[model samples]
Target: MADTLRHYGPAAVAWVLLAYRVSKGRRGAPDPARDTVWLVLLGLSLSLTLLTPAVYAFTGRVSGVPNLARLLGHGSMLVVAWSARTFLWHLNHPITEVQPRTRLHLGFLAATFAAMSVLFVLADTPVDDARFAARYAGDPWVLEYWLVYIAYLTPAFASMAVLGWAYAHMSTAPLLRVGLRLVAIGAFLAIGYNLHKALVFASERFGFSYPPAGHLLIDGVLPMLAHLLVLIGATLPAWGRLVNAPESLAWLSRYRTYQALRPLWRALYAASPHIALTPASPALVELVTVRDLNLRLYRRVIEIRDGRLALMPYLDLDTATAARARAAQAGLSGQALDAAAEAAALHAALHAKALGATAVFGPASHTPGGGDLDSDTVFLRDVARAFHRLERQSHHG
Candidate 1:
C-alpha cells in the first residue's frame, strides 16, 4: 500500500494540477504568479514520474548510466523548490521587486545542480539500484552528493514554510489563504523528510544502523504526501475562482427559481392567455432553449403578477381565511403559513375563474408581500413550492 501510494499518488495529483493550470492559461492573460505555479506543478509531476521504479530503470538502461534517473529526479525536485519560492515571491511582491531576485535565485539553482552533477559523476556506483541511497551509503562521493542535495533543499523548504504561513495569514481571499496554509504545512513536512534523510546518511557513515523502513517512510510516504499537498494548494485558489464566482452562483439560482416557477406560471397562463407577453413554449423545450435567464425571470414574475390581478375578481376571502386556519392547524407559522395560505387562495381563485362564478371580491387577498424584485421572486418561489405540495396532497388524498 505504501509503495503504491508513494509511486502513483503524487504523480497523479501533480499531473492533474499541471493539466488544469495549462487549460486555464489558454484563456487568461500571462501572469507571472500563475506561470510560476505552473512550473512548480510541472516540476513536481516530472520528479514523481521519473522516480517511479519502471521509469527510473528504463531511463538508467537507456542512458547507459546507472541510477541516472536519481540525478534527473533530484534535478526536477530542485526545479519544484525553486519555482515554488518564485511563486510565493511573485505573490508577495511586484514585478520590479521580483525581477532582481530572479537572477540570484536562478544562479544559486544552477550552481547547486552543477555541484550535484559533478558529485554524481565522481561517485563509483556502476549498479543501478532503485534504493540508491541505502545501497551506496557511506561510499565516498555518494555521501557528499546526498549531503549537497540535502543542504540545498533544507533551506529552500524552510523558507517556503515560513513565507507560506506568513502570507496565508496576510491574505484576504478565503481560498487563497487556505491554499497558502496547506502549502506551508507541506513545506514543513518536506523539511522533516530532508532532516530524516540527512540523519540516515549520517548514521550510515558513522557505522550505525537505521531501519530500512525509515527509508520507505521518509522517501516514499513523506515526500508523496508533501507533494500532493503542495500541488493541491497551488491549484485551489484558481479552481475556486473558476467555480465559485458570484455571477455563476446567481445565474444558477435564477435558473433553478425559473424552473420552479413553471407550474404556477403554466396554470395562470392557461386561465388567462393574454397574461403572457410571449406565447409559452413546451416545458422541456423552454428548459433546453431558454437563455437570458434574468430577463426571462423578470418577465415571468410580471406575467404571474398580471395573472393574479386578472383573477382577483374571483378571489374569495373565505377561501384564504380557511386556508390560513388549516395551515395554522398544520403547525405552519410566519412566511411558511403565509405562503401556504396564498397558494390555497390562488388555487381556489383559478377554479372559480374557470367555473364562470360571479365576481365576489373586495381588496385582493394573499397579495405577496415583498419590497423588491428579488424578495418577490423568493416569496413567489415559496408559494410555487407550497402550491405543488397542496396539489400533490389533494391528488393523493
Candidate 2:
C-alpha cells in the first residue's frame, strides 16, 4: 500500500494541478506567478512519473543506459525546485530586482546540473536498479552524486519553506494564505526527505546498515506526502475562481436559505392556505426536489411575507414585548433577540388564529426590517431558526 501510494500519489497530484492550471489559464490574462507555478507543477509531474518503478525500468531499458531514469528524475526535481524559487522571487520582489537574481540562480542550477551529470557518468552503475541508491550505496561516485543532489536540494527547500511561511503571513487573501502555508509545510517535509536520504547514503558509505523500511518511507511515502501538500497549496488559490465560482456559491447560499425557511413557511402556510400562490409539496417530495431553486426561493420568501401580513391582526404587542424581555434575560442580543421576539409573537399569533379568536387590534402594521431581498432572506432565516428552537422548547415544556 505504501509503495503504491508513493508511486502514484505525487504523479496524480501533479497531473491534477497541471490540468487545473491549464483550464484556469484559458479564462484569464497571462500571469507570471501562475506561469511559474505551471512550470513547477510540470517539473513535479515529470519527476514523479519518471521515478515510478515501471517508467524507471522502461526508460533504462529503452535508453540502454543503467538507471538513466534516476538522473532524469533528479534533473526534473532540480527544475521543480528552481521554478518554485523563481515563482516565490517573482511574487515577493520587483521585476528589476528579480531579473539579476534569476540569472544568477539559473547559472548556479546549470552548474549543479552539469556536476551531477558528470558524477552520474563516472559512477559504475552498469545495471538498471529500481533501488538505485541502496544498490550503489557504497560506490564512491554514486555517493558523490547523491551528496551533490542533496547539496542542491537542501538549501533550496529550506529557503522555500522560510519564504513560503513569511509570504503566507504577509498575504491578505484567505485562500492564498492557506496555499502558501501548505507549500511551506511541503517544503519542510521535503527537507526531511532530503536529510533521510543523505543519512541512508552516508550510513551505507560508512559500512553501517540502515533499516530497510526507512527506504520506503524516504523514497515513496515522504516524497508523495510532500508533493501532495505542495500541489494542493499551488492550486488552492484558484479554487474560488475555478471550482467555487461566485454564481455557484450564491446558488448554494440561496438553496440553504430556502431550506432554512421551511419550518416557518410550513407553519404560516397551515394557518393561512391562501398566502401561497401554489399548493405546498409533501415534505419528503420538497426535500428531494431542487428544480428552479432561485424561483422557488423567491416564491417562498414572498409567500412568507404575505403569511406574516395575514397573521398581523392576531400579533399581540404585549406578547412581543414580553418575549423580547425574556430573550434579553436569556442572553440573546442583536439579531438573536429580534428573531426570538418575532418567533414568539408569530407563535402566539398562530395559536390565537387556531383558537378562532377575532382580531383584538385591527391589523397591527409591521414589516420585516430589510431593504433588499438578500437581507430579507437573511433576517427570515434567523427568524426561522428561532421559530424552530421555540417549537422544540414548547414541545419539551
Candidate 3:
C-alpha cells in the first residue's frame, strides 16, 4: 500500500537476486551474451535499490517514477558498459546468432548514453544557469528518462521480432518453448511501460504545467509497475514453470529453429516429410564445417512405439543391370552368380548399420537397402508414445 520493504520490496529484492544468481543457466558452459543480459538487469536492480531510498527522502515533492527514471539512466550506464564488454567477449571467442545482434544493441545503448549525456550537459553546464537551476535542480535529464526508456524499447522490440521470426528453427524440448514465450510476453510488457512513459511526456499540457485529479500516472503509478517488471523478470526462474522451461524454450524464439537443419537431413533421403510446421528466419550457418559426407539422413523422428529408419544400399540401376547381364552370361557357362548377389546383400547390411537402423525390407532388385516405411509418420510418434506407455507399465508393475 505505502510501498514498504515487507510489502513488496523484499520480494522484489529476492527475485532480483534469483535472476542474478540463477540465470547463468543450469548445466551449460557460460554464454557471455546471456551473462551480459543478467548483469545489466542486476545492475539496473542495484541502481533501483539505491535510488528507491533517495526517492523516499524526496517523496512528497518529486515523483518516485521520475526518480526511478534518473536511476535507470544511471544504472543503464553500467548495463551499456557491460553490454559492450559482452560484445568484446563474443568477438574474442564466438557466439553465432547473438554477435551481430549484440552489436546492434550496443549501437542503441550508445544512442541512449549520448542522449542522456547531452541532456545532462545541457542542464548542468554554466552556459545556462537559469535553465540549469530550473531544470537540473528539479527534473534535470527528464528527457534522459524517456530516451533511456526508448533505447531499451529498441532491443525489446528487436528481440521479440527477431525471436518470433527465428522461433521455428529450434530443436529442443517442449517446456522450453513455453519458457521462451513467457519471456517474450514479459518483454512485451516492458515495452508497453516504456512506450507509455514516452507518451506521458509528450505534452506538458496533460498536467506537467498544471495538476491532475489525484496524481500523474508516470510520476505516481509507474514506479510500482517498474518494480513489478523487475520482480517478474527476476522471479520467473524460481517458478516451477521456468525451472522446467530452459530445457526447451531458450531455443524457441518467436522464430522457429527446426527448419534450418532440414536440408541436411533431406540430402540423405530426398523425400523428407514436413511434420512440424513453423515460421522461417534467416539462415545462420554453424561456424564449423561438418565434414562427414557419407551421412545419410532417412530424416526420421522417433516417438517411442515403433521406428522405421531401416536403411539399405541399392546398386545403381545401370550397375545392377550390367551385373545381372554379366551374371547371366556367366550362368550359361556354368559359373555361379552367388558372388554378385552376396556383394549386394553385404552392401545393404552396411547401409542399415550406418543409418542406425536394425531392420531392412524390400527386394534386392527393387528398393535396394530400404525398409518397411509406414509412410504416415506414425513410426516416430508411435515409438515415442510407446516408450511413455512402457515407463508407466513398468512403474505400475
lDDT tens digits by residue: candidate 3, 1-397: 5645523473366445656467545557766744554664565555455445444335313442333334343545346343534533442355776677667766766676666656654543332221122244335455455566466655654455346324412514344234334434544555665565554454332345432444344444454554454444333444535455554343332112223223322222332233322222223542232322112112232211011132233223454455546667756222123334323333334344556664434454542221353332222222223223433454698
lDDT of 2 at 240: 55
**Tens digits of lDDT, candidate 2, 120-147:** 9999999898888768877878778878
Taking every candidate in turn, the Cα RMSD to the unseen true structure, in Å, is 13.7, 10.0, 17.4
- Give the Cα-based TM-score of candidate 1 against the true structure: 0.59
Q: In what order do the candidates fall by TM-score, top score first?
A: 2, 1, 3
- Give all TM-scores, in the order shown: 0.59, 0.60, 0.42
Clashes of 3: 30
Which window of ten consecutive residues has the lowest lDDT sum in model 3?
A: 299-308
Specify the highest-TM-score model's number. Answer: 2
lDDT of each: 0.84, 0.85, 0.42
Q: Which ten residues in a row have the lowest lDDT in candidate 2?
A: 361-370
Regions of candidate 1 where Cα sits further than 4 Å from its true position: 26-28, 209-215, 241-397
Q: How well is each residue in 14-121 modelled by candidate 1, as lDDT tens digits?
A: 887788777766555778987888788888899889888888899999999999999999999998888888888988899899988877878888999999999999
Off by over 4 Å in 2: 26-29, 209-215, 240-397
Q: List the residue pairs that clash in candidate 1.
A: none
lDDT of 1 at 314: 83
